[model samples]
Target: MYYIAHRLFAAHDRALGALIARQLAKKAGPESVFLPFCDTDEEDLVAPVKGHRLFELDRERLQTLTGMIAVLHGPSLDDGVCMEIGYAAALNVPVVVVTTDFQTYSADEHSPHWAFPDPLIETIAHRVTRVDRLGAPQLADSPDRFTAFAARNQAQIETAAAMSVEAILELAANNCPAPAPARAEAGTVFLEPSPHIRCPEALLDTLHAAHRSVTIAIRHQAPDPFTAAHADWTTALRAEVLVADVSGPETPPGGAVLIGAAAALRRRIAAHLPTAVITHAHGREPNWRNLMIQYAVGTRVCDAHSLARWLAS
Candidate 1:
């Protein structure tokens, strides 16, 4: 099966998604192409899905996918699509990233990093397809023009989908990366906590007892500049173990990305490096945590004590 990750929060996005899905299904089979907007449970249509449940549902579908074709649209890559790409890559599942946007938005052309579509994401992907001049057809003047514009530009949309589908089929046929050699245990434990953690020192003090070689990267200490942020993420992926604290009512966006990347790395390498996701004891409800992080890490919430125990064991 193939999963198409794209933005569907807008009317144009939904219409384009349907068009792409239809074309992909024609070539890959109706049952093979899974578009989140079209294939979701019926109840999701009637009401808003609880955050955790949505994450759980997507991750479950991801596990069964043979390859993923992620639409990297807009000036910046969508955070959720990045998570899906990272997660799928970690599982050694082949990924093909398709972007119709031709405008350049790089920090520096000479630099090894891309300011858009994200360098790490591109690095992990098996194939990157750029359909020049066939940019998104949904950039109509108004919302009402979306349908008419799509209808008029059907040829361009089909061309883009056809190119993406070609890449997906080719990659799926022969591009699965082999898992790294398994290790008994990972060397270092990397901790990513939200800036909102209460009594941070006490929490670290407790965890330090179980593991001495722990690296902590919180939002404040790590500069938000792209280069520094990229460096921190690269360092985190090198560690054999990852522990992310996602306590509180919502998962901090930055912390959630790190959790997703680390979890994918752990899975890609098999049982070599394990990832642990912990939340504050106060917010132990399953819905409090992002389902992608929870299911990908595959662990129960670890308070300081339990986290330390997990680190030691």
Candidate 2:
């Protein structure tokens, strides 16, 4: 079976995503294709399930999936879809990213290459099927318009889905080995230090107190130091375990990308590289807007004391 990961918040996402999944199922078999939002009841808005529960459900499904067809739509890549790609890639499952975004955004401002979303995502994909959506009309709130939008993009959707199916099959047929594990000291943890992190010294001190070796992988922002940030992100991905302070006044650019990488690393269940996210508990909830981060890591601690306790256990 294959998992279909896409943004589900909007009418356009739902309409286009359903069309793609239906078309994909015709080629891959009806039983071979799964869309979490459509197939599962756990995400129902009425009496909604916890984010982690949904994460667990999806992770379980993904573990058994032969490949993943991820819809990489919009100007910015969807955080949740990116996490799924990382997780699937870590498991050595072939992933095909299908995008219809026509806007131009560069991975590096200084470089000549122009692209939407991040290379941290696209670089790892087995294949990226990019369809042109310039002719499709904007989605309206009405159901008829939504249908019209899907109809107009039917050829593009079918083409992308067909390419994705072929890519998945081609990649799955190859027997490529997973990269060798990084040479990390036992009990070593990679710390993704962010400017949004509070009491960074205390986090370091906590690691030192536990007698665990640490590697600080910093993701630089702005003026887009793409190469440097990518190197550090790879460092974080290869570490034994990852610990990041996701406490947010606001999510820094590229912050979610680091978390997504860590999420992927954590899915290496055989390697046991657990990832921890540290965020302040606001009233009862963590003070973060992004549920993708919570879904990615699942372990969120409020302070160094809590972190130390977690590490100790």
Q: Each model's TM-score? A: 0.63, 0.70
How would you encode candidate 2's per-residue C-alpha lDDT over 1-313 as one tens digit per residue?
8888887667778776787678778876889888876776534533234554556677778777688888876665566676677667656678888887776566355653434445456556778888766345645553686676666677677677677777776776683765643343457677755543443577789888988777765433434445555666566666666676544343332445556555655521111112334444222234244455566664566667877777776
> With candidate 2 superimposed using the best TM-score fit, by how many Å does residue 158's alpha carbon deviate from the native?
4.1
- lDDT tens per residue, model 1, 1-313: 8898876556777676677778788888989888885687423444344445566667778877788887777554554666677667656688887777666443445544342433445555678777656335554465577665655466566677788888888888886465752232356666666545543564568657754566776423433335555555666667676665655444443454555666655532111112334333222243323345455564544455555555555
- On lDDT, the leading prediction is 2
Q: Cα deviation in Å at residue 233, candidate 2?
A: 5.3
**Off by more than 4 A, model 1:** 42-49, 108-117, 134-156, 180-187, 191-210, 214-258, 264-313
Residue 98, model 1: Cα distance from true site in angstroms: 1.1
